[model samples]
Target chain A: MKPVSVLKVLSIGLLAAGLVGCGKQETSKGELIVKIGSVAPLTGPQAHLGKDNENGARLAIDEANARGVTIGGKKATFVLIGEDDQADPKTATIVAQKLADQQVKGVIGHLNSGTSIPASKIYADAGIVQISPSATAVAYTAQGFRSALRVMTNDRQQGKVLGEFAVKHLGAKRVAIIDDRTAYGQGLADEVEKAVKAAGGGVVAREYTSDRSTDFTAILTSIKGKTPDVVFYGGMDPQAAPMAKQMQGLGLKARFLSGDGAQTQEFLKLAGPAAEGVSASMPGMPLDLMPGGKSFRERFNAKYGVIQNYAPYAYDAVNAMILAMEKAGSPEPAMYLPELVKLRFTGVTGEIGFDERGDVLGGAITLYHVRNGRWEVLDTVQGESAGKSK
Target chain B: MDIFVQQLINGLVLGSIYALVALGYTMVYGILELINFAHGEVTMVGAMVCLAVVGWLLGLGMAVPWPVILMLGLGAAVVACMVLGFSIERIAYRPLRRAPRLAALITAIGVSIVLQNVAMLVWGKQYVSFPALVPVVRYEIAGATITALQVVIVLLSGALMAGLWLLVKRTGLGRAMRATAQSPELAGLMGVNPNRVISITFVIGALLAAIAGVMVSAYYGLAHYYMGFLLGLKAFTAAVLGGIGNIAGAMLGGLLLGVIESIGAGYIGDLSFGFLGSHYQDVFAFFVLILVLVFRPAGLLGERVAERA
Candidate 1:
């Protein structure tokens, strides 16, 4: 072999390797990928609800990208990357870590309070802003993270309203409380207990149940023994519906009540005829009542042939995110964070504005009753009114 | 006493569904000794297929009666699950049959993951209300209220179990299955196609699981992509409790476990320590499994077989 031929071959090999490396680098550095991460229960029991929140965030990202938003004076498009936490806190933490590794600038999840409470710390430490469309735990945004905000109101306000409804509206002297023992369930239960006690109403009995359990005969029997006028359950619909049915089966005729977690068609299906007269307190007005929600509801019904729970809040969350981006004139988290904090925008649910604590300010909590297997709006009360009731 | 009877009936109804699914698990394990972790996902697929069929029938303006719908749904589920079972055996299990058990188990896990994600992609991660093929009307017998659907689930499971028992005991294929189970090499020498028997076992198991899935989706009125996970775990627990390789034992174990959980939830309330509520029902089942495994490793009716090695 000639020396010149060997040199030429070696140079060609080096050039090939360099080109491959450059190709990899180019693929990795495709124009500052500003990832908007979302965490939700994509695989477990609550996957349906979590997907709703994820879809809302995706809609916002899609709209932003379509319009070519600028961040840091450079045209940038938002990219959404989603992870399924399965509504588990540990899984949520892992998802948060993955997002951090990918260097996502912002996150628009997680749905469940139990998962969000721990996952938020990961985002906070990583300097990624997290805005949850659902998680209703009072402590969710209270950790003092400048970047944490929740589009939904806390259980504290919901609890107070429930207590007030029991006393002032239902004229109940005594109420029984039951919780499903999850963070969301127990937190709302505790708040309701406190508010009911403060309202000079007697809490005749308090009990707990598990989220996966279908039978509630024993708990209902115990509550029947107490003979309370009303029963407030702080749990999601899966357990709440069956609990309502079992309560009826056990001959406990106490009026059933619950929080936003129980506000769904699943509850009615589970409870069946037993669900009649049961009331639940939910954040924001019903879809038909909200001005923008009417069209959204029609479109959703047309597309899916069913009215979904939490669609209004989901729509509002996306609108709020988009409005904040428009106001900030950029997609950069650091640039838009302050603008998001100060922006007041009208959304499908209502006028969306966040307080310093990142809670929805001036939010109206509505009470609904299951009538003929449908959720019907009963009354709407503001946060201040709810607080006063407490 | 009446309340006890009612609770027992409820338990029996729920147990039959669990047992029906558990049979699939136990039979697959009896032949292949692999858990077939994707069995529950197969059930989910079956239920979803039924849902899609019903939706399509309704869309086509065909008022196909409830019984016809149910029959068609079950048939569709069976066919779909059989195809899935065959493919899983071929792609994931066959190549690794000679490999370590851990490899096969890992492959099963991968299959389960792939099926779950595929289900999510196809179903769109939402809970769709499954149509009620049977009237959900309730009937009171001796002061206990029971739904028509519950009765159907219980009767259908019993009939299927009987049919399965006869199939395994009376048919030549059944003899081959038994021979293979006893000794695969000996069965191969005796002109019994061991591989064919194994495939047949999977097909039967998949059929049972599909029936169970249809029954459950009808009972629950709602089905989701991940509905299989918890139900599969529960069915596995039922299988283990009854002796993993025992056919009839699985059915007995399922019924007993359901009754016990219901009774525990009913009497214990929030005061029965760990059995305070319904969510702790799984805990109760797990506790029973641990107790059973510690006391009777061969299960209640399970017979000890010679190790393959």
Candidate 2:
């Protein structure tokens, strides 16, 4: 009887604690505490990029809080609630639901398209705006989710620039393409394949690999038999770096090309000397060439060590959401959602605006090649005409 | 012809590492009849340990030669994994020896997961690069290139396998080990310490796995905490393909599996009319396993053993 009484008392106390924890009260007389969610793979192979995005969002939040933003006649304090999705789709949706339940007004991430596509619906249903900093799959925004948008250009624009450059600039007549089979990688490869054909280059081989694979010898050997002039990989640095090394080892003389996922500092480090002569395409202009890029880079580097990739876009994502909140005069998602869709500004990455389908408008793609262990810009292609071509 | 040669080279290199790892699984399974799932994590730990040492040595800015640094790293990885393997068996497996076989299997998995997460914490989640310790010198043969490292891997693996075969066949400890494998109780009655033999077996397996780990990291040019999972899985598949408790079977199975995977990946697109690409390489490995188990349950080189039940 005494043990049962003790158990009843413990259950009652737990229920009361849960209720008290769930209830929120605003304090300090019109000082609004706005919760913003940032989701990325904080732990995994892509953690470096994910952490860069988180740091970018944090820097924006810190700057906004320091400046003391005002929303609806109240002083606003932006609080970033960072969640690790581990770059997994299932984990991304769980994190999204958690953020939604936590009443976060906006989300500044989901770094990969596979995670973003599934999580976008959860955010939309919850009336929270999701501004992805790095997801590039075109299907992400084309899903008709009003709350979905991105600060960076989508894969369609980036892939076209890569394909045309491989043919017209690199003089590639026969091309080989490989993708990691992720939504983002496959989508970009599809676009690159189409653009290569349109640019009068023949695709000699099309191969697929998983994102987790490190061995590429068998596939590379198969592709080598075709003797393609250039080999393009649609995957992140983790897989791409190994492929590059293996290609070199196999005496495959074809030039290596990749999308923005491999245009990263980690790529150079992992691939070592094999990274030399590898060409890659990234969205947006060269960082130094962007409007506010130089100064922003110094500040970001001073705070976060080095920018891996997508940090500038992540910064702009948070800034755009905050600007929308300021314009709408409320931090509530419903109030700022419409303003966010129509917002336009010059960001660190250059002009930031979304089209009807939520893809960035008038974006640019930069081509780079690794030389002497560093990325050097080869050319920059504006996406306005490319967008029309799509 | 060039494609065939290139893929053969690739498959042999890949298979050699698998054979080293499968030997660990087969040895443990031979004696204890328990699948030591954590054997894979031990391999991962070996790689991570070696890389950490290499990174630390390079950071010291000492003028030690590259080969010296490579040897030192390999030495440290082997020693560390030997101790780790012993501790894992002592702490996780020995206590459960008399328990149900299922319990020991579950504990092995638990130890594996713990090792993976612990490695993730120590090494962080980034793919740590393995520096080019071995100088790259490629030789072109029939339009296919083979690096000095590839030749070393195959040669070293062959030497190690021959050495291991001699150890198991001609050594006194091998007689003790074989006796224990037959019956632990009878071996104990015959004055062979089963526990000691088992611990020694784990240490030897760890040594081979450590060397295999370093080879894989060098070959792939990067090491990650999760690298062990897939590598171990493939090696386990190899062991089963050769016949799970047989050492010779593991070796044969590993090389066969590797060649099968490489050639399958090379020709899968053609065989399936472009419907299935080389990404189905993993499928070929498991598919072979299924075919072998269905037709020849004892494996390619495995002998049929009567069940006690």
Candidate 3:
């Protein structure tokens, strides 16, 4: 019995030694490690776009790693730990707290405006830098959180551009507006309605639906009765695609317009031929036109097989954070955050800088028309650029 | 006037789907005195099964008639839902039959979550486009243009409901089902197989839900894992509106609810001076339910004692 007990003790000691040996792999001889947290709807309805945003951050970190970043006289390795928020505000706040607890040097994401707004408070309280890739709501940056910033242009700019395009370019005198009633959707729609009225277009009708609703037949019928020349929907692609198809089915002859949420390949695939003549907007320069966008797209297509919508913005977000950290000569959030607010760098999405409100400076909205079953850039309107041609 | 007719057509088309799903709720409540919250997930599974069968058959490039392929899809959906309904009863509900009502209700909720997650895994948690099997065209009816599918939905719903009414009133199986509902032990003593009768009743309800699910997918041209959640909720409201355990009441309740929602949405801005909009359509359904509960506690067609049930 004594001999058996000794054998068991030896085996246990050896197993524990082996397990300890397996955990830590040495890639750095005195190399400093910094983690950047990313949040998106990784497991739900918008996962395709969420994965695209995540891929952007991952690709940026890998490229940044290859360049061999050094801060505070120490070689640094950047890591991204992504959390799935389901594009939900509650989940966003919960994960925001978790990432703050993990002490990630900086953060990137909470992709929907609804989520980004709520989660920003948590990061601000924790003194962590948060850069949103694609939350375009006007109210997001308006909250005045020193730590909260976004790479993409907000809905105020997108809606103004879209409304102008519909009235002046499409030559529409009457417009109908519909929203999904989410914080993002309603905010965008209100802006569009305001812009439309300012652009000398008559508001014919207004309708709303829930995010979970599939049936829009009744609302479409009512909207059709108003006979507007253009109908704009402020919602995500899943609902937008079906609504587009239903509009055609209901014999509504008005042209369809939406913002970045409906401007996706999934919309083309889901809406089929109904997507042919629709118009939408994204909050950046066209990918091909941006200086770094071409190389980024090439590498991204090679790595992830597609660029949904926010990849370029996400890439810029990661680059912007790293630029701030490099400028500060530190990887700590508290040390780097002040520099992040004013850091100016040319990234894949364009020249990256922020104003007092943490909104991207010189923000632009790129208008797109679906031609030949693909998004064709119609115009690029930078706030300072005065209608640059796409 | 044309818009009003158009909305009415939309309401009826919507109502037909609601009526079919409501029957499932009403039937189970009639026979088992259980709510079966998992009933919605059963509908979701039915729709997904139909989509999967159709997609697989289309992918294989089989040169079959459209009608034939559609029939195969419906058949697949019905069978899958029946199997799911049976297992849910056997695995989740039967053991809890002798337990407290709260336990069974809690188990039903758990089963609902399990089905939703399992479906999310299988279907990939995104809105999948349900292909247009029918020709995409509309026919004008009284200044209201409606697709051929809408007419089919309305006609089919009426036929299904009528057939169900006849089956319950005039069939031997229906007699056994009613006997079991009245008193399971007494029915067993009277030589009726109570378990078998109950199982058949559950499957019958599932069959109705399955057909409704397929029609909804075709009508909307989209299907997702969570699609059944709201549809199930609306159907439950309809079930309660018609007296929880009544069959024809479910049909009437569904139609009335649909019309109310449609008209309420159409005229809400005018009614409220633009303070409220069509988005509040869901609110009207619950408001009616609350009003009915306040004024007529037994529901429109519900009896005081549930003696027939």
Which of candidates 1 and 2 is the stronger one according to DockQ?
A: 2
What's candidate 3's DockQ score? Answer: 0.54
Better of 2 and 3 by lDDT: 2
Report lDDT (Cα) of residue B83, candidate 3: 90
Top candidate by DockQ = 2
Tens-digit lDDT string for candidate 3 (A1-390): 345434543563454345335422224376677778888887656888888999999999999999999887778888777777777799789888877766677888978888999999999999899999988888888998888999889888888888888899889999999999997788889999999999999889988988877778778888888899999999899989889888988889899999888988888878877788999988887777887877888999998997887888888899989988888989888888889886777777777788778888768788888999899988888764312311
| Model-by-model DockQ, in order | 0.11, 0.66, 0.54
Look at candidate 3 and give me any clashing residue pairs: none
Give the per-residue lDDT digits (tens) of candidate 3, residues B1-309.
999998898888888888899999888888788998999888888899999999888888979888788889999999999998888888998888889888988998999899999999999878887766777778887878888888999999999999999888899888888788778999999999988887888888889899998998888777889888888888888888888888988998888888878888887876788899888888888888898778776668887774533
- Candidate 3 local lDDT, residue B183: 87
Q: How accurate is candidate 3 locally (lDDT)?
A: 0.85
iRMSD value for model 1: 4.6
lDDT (C-alpha, whole model) for all candidates:
0.76, 0.90, 0.85
What CAPRI-style quality would you assign to candidate 3? medium
lDDT of 1 by residue, B1-309 (tens): 666666677678778988988988888888778888888888888888888887677668776787887788778888998888888888889898889988988988899889889989988775666654565466767756677777888999999999999888899988898888777899999999888888888888888888888887776665778878877888888888888878888888888887877666545654555344444555777888888878877777777654721
Please write out the lDDT profile of model 2 over residues A276-299, one tens digit for every residue: 999999887777888888898898
Per-residue lDDT of model 2, residues B171-202, tens digit only: 99998988998899999999999999999999
lDDT of 1 by residue, A1-390 (tens): 245434533463454345444542123434333556777776656757766766666655675677776544455656666677778789789878877766676788788788888988998888777888777899998889878887777888788889888887888888999898888898899999988888889888777777665556545655665679999999888778767765654556689999988888777765667778999988766667776776766655564444445656765665566566667765556777898888776776667778888888767789999787789889988664212321
